[model samples]
Target: MTQLSLHSPVGELTISEEDGVIVSVDWGWSPFQEENELLLRAKKMLDDYFDGEEVEFDLPLKPHGTEFQKNVWKIMSEIPYGQILTYGEISDRLNSHARAVGLACGANPIPIIIPCHRVMGKNGKLTGFSGGEGISTKRYLLELEDTFNNLDDNLSLPF
Candidate 1:
């Protein structure tokens, strides 16, 4: 596996890759010391994302989790870069329940790639983020994507 470290507003990120596919993107409690071709690409991609120059990611991903978790992650990836969803909405999509979706979000191994931050509570409130970073980080990311701007002004119940 190859690893690369980069900086973000939340913290330093360490992106791990295996077999040429990204396996994880983790927040580092300490600075990571490694670099490689895959890491470079990951850095560039993340930079572009933070810079608002990219939306959907095109890098190889190798998430390791249960089938349900993978499904949740897949749905999360489908969320537009600037859009957000509620746990209940994801459960409806999966024919499951909000608790189940929340569990899946908590178990998300790939954060930014899978886009767990894009998930919010009903009423467009920033909710749980299991990345150990906090919902504020999630909000920051969402705001970066312009998903939160004017959200307060357009407060209409979706369901």
Candidate 2:
């Protein structure tokens, strides 16, 4: 596994990949050490994204998963930057049920790059995020994308 650390608005992220495919992306260090090349490039794109200078990622990413999961990730990859999509919409597109779509979303191997955080429940409700950052972190990501326009005043950010 190859690893690289990236700084973001929420926190520092460590992204890992193996055989040119993303293996893991977590909030902190992992015990395993591996060489990193494209990992560094991913960090750079993430930086540009958080800085609001870049909307889309241009990187070779292969998220390993089952065929169903891969299909879910493909639809997720189409979610334009700074935009949000309901889980139901994804289900409709994939001709699957909403619950199944949610399951695939929770199993997303890559978060920011795959843009899994852009998926939400019906009516803009925050849903599950498998990166283990919790709902607050998920909300922060949505806010960064300018998709959470109805957050409470206290939760509103200056930027």
Candidate 3:
């Protein structure tokens, strides 16, 4: 896998690619770095996104996962920027369960580009995030995009 690191508001992020397709976007920096046209473009899009530029990523994403997880990721990818979706909504769309959908969201390899942070818990509750500073990272992304429709700033999560 080829990895490239970029600095964002949340912290350092490392984007991984394989076979010319983006496979993951992870927190922190990678020990190794390789520059390429694809990785460079992915970095640029992420920069725009963090800068609140409403960038629609045109890069090819191939997050490594199972069929169900892939389906979940696909649904998440379609969620427009500055929009939110609940686990229940995704479960209903997939004919699955909310817990399952949440699990898939947690397992998402690519975070921002796939928009997993846009997903909320029951009644727009903030939940666990696997990247950066957990729910805080999710909150920052949501706040950055101004997509907190049902979420309030007065949760116990300490913003």
**Over all chains combined, what TM-score does candidate 1 have?**
0.87
Question: 37 in model 3: Cα distance from truth in Å?
Answer: 0.4
For each candidate in the order shown, give its overall lDDT on alpha carbons.
0.80, 0.77, 0.89
Model 3 Cα shift for residue 123 (angstroms): 1.6
Of 1 and 3, the candidate ahead on TM-score is 3
- Return the lDDT, model 2, position 27: 79
Model 1: per-residue Cα lDDT over 68-123, one tens digit each:
88999899989877777889999999999988898899888778878988887777
Candidate 2 wrong stretches, greater than 4 Å: 31-35, 149-159
Which pairs clash (backbone N, Cα, C closer than 3 Å) in model 1?
none
Model 3 residue 23 CA deviation in Å: 0.6
Which has the higher lDDT value, candidate number 2 or candidate number 3? Answer: 3
* lDDT of candidate model 2 versus the reference: 0.77
TM-score of each: 0.87, 0.83, 0.92
Which pairs clash (backbone N, Cα, C closer than 3 Å) in model 2?
A: none
Query: In what order do the candidates fall by TM-score, top score first?
Result: 3, 1, 2
Model 3, position 145: C-alpha lDDT score: 83
